[model samples]
Target: MCYAKKLNFKLKTCTTLSRVNALSSVAVKFAAYLCTIDSPDIANDYLKVQSLQEIAALIGTTSRHLNRVLQKWTEQQIISRTDDMIHIKDWQAIQEISEDIRFV
Candidate 1:
């Protein structure tokens, strides 16, 4: 897969820990840097992915509300799409427009 995997600033934690599961691998990498707009609302430690219904139950909000929140974010271009999946362009872009970022 052509992943736009940001050079995670949290690499130290990743290397220090032995077991980085699929969910953790994605969540921690995102949380440490890329989770600004495209992040899930839940504090996904070890990434326990609950169904939409389960998530709605925990947060006391319907899935429709959550979808609306996500849709607004998409419209802002604060986050973006890639091959039907979300990808953070870079860690640095979290604080600014993605287009304003430059590699130095």
Candidate 2:
């Protein structure tokens, strides 16, 4: 019983860490995408089409989970969303969130 409990605890911890790492990676890449806000890559007649499902697939996660992460960013005013489009409210903050990585 003791061994089972230890193993379960380790497994849960590993799962949690994996989720955190994955979410961090997604956040970084998402910020990079936002950097293209004014370019043709994101601009479609001045509206960026950023689909949650597409981004989730790129980040190797489900859209439902990615949505939660995005919601938190939205709550903090990091990004604004209108339907499937998104606009970065603070590019500098996003760069900081992405650990100062070059967005180009």
lDDT of each: 0.38, 0.60
Poorest 10 consecutive residues of model 2 by lDDT?
41-50
C-alpha displacement of 104 in model 2, angstroms? 8.4
Q: Pick the candidate with the highest TM-score.
A: 2
Supply candidate 1's per-residue lDDT for 6: 24
Which pairs clash (backbone N, Cα, C closer than 3 Å) in model 1?
Answer: none
Give stretches of model 2 more than 4 Å off: 1-25, 36-50, 100-104
* Best-fitting candidate, scored by lDDT: 2
How many clashing pairs does model 1 include?
A: 0
- In model 1, where do residues sit more than 4 Å from their true spots? 1-47, 81-85, 88-104
Error of 1 at 46 (Å): 6.1
- The alpha-carbon RMSD values of the candidates against the true structure, listed in the order shown, are 13.1, 12.8
Give the per-residue lDDT digits (tens) of candidate 2, residues 1-104: 39886587556434433444453566775665455444454332322334777556544568888787789899999889997676779878887766643223
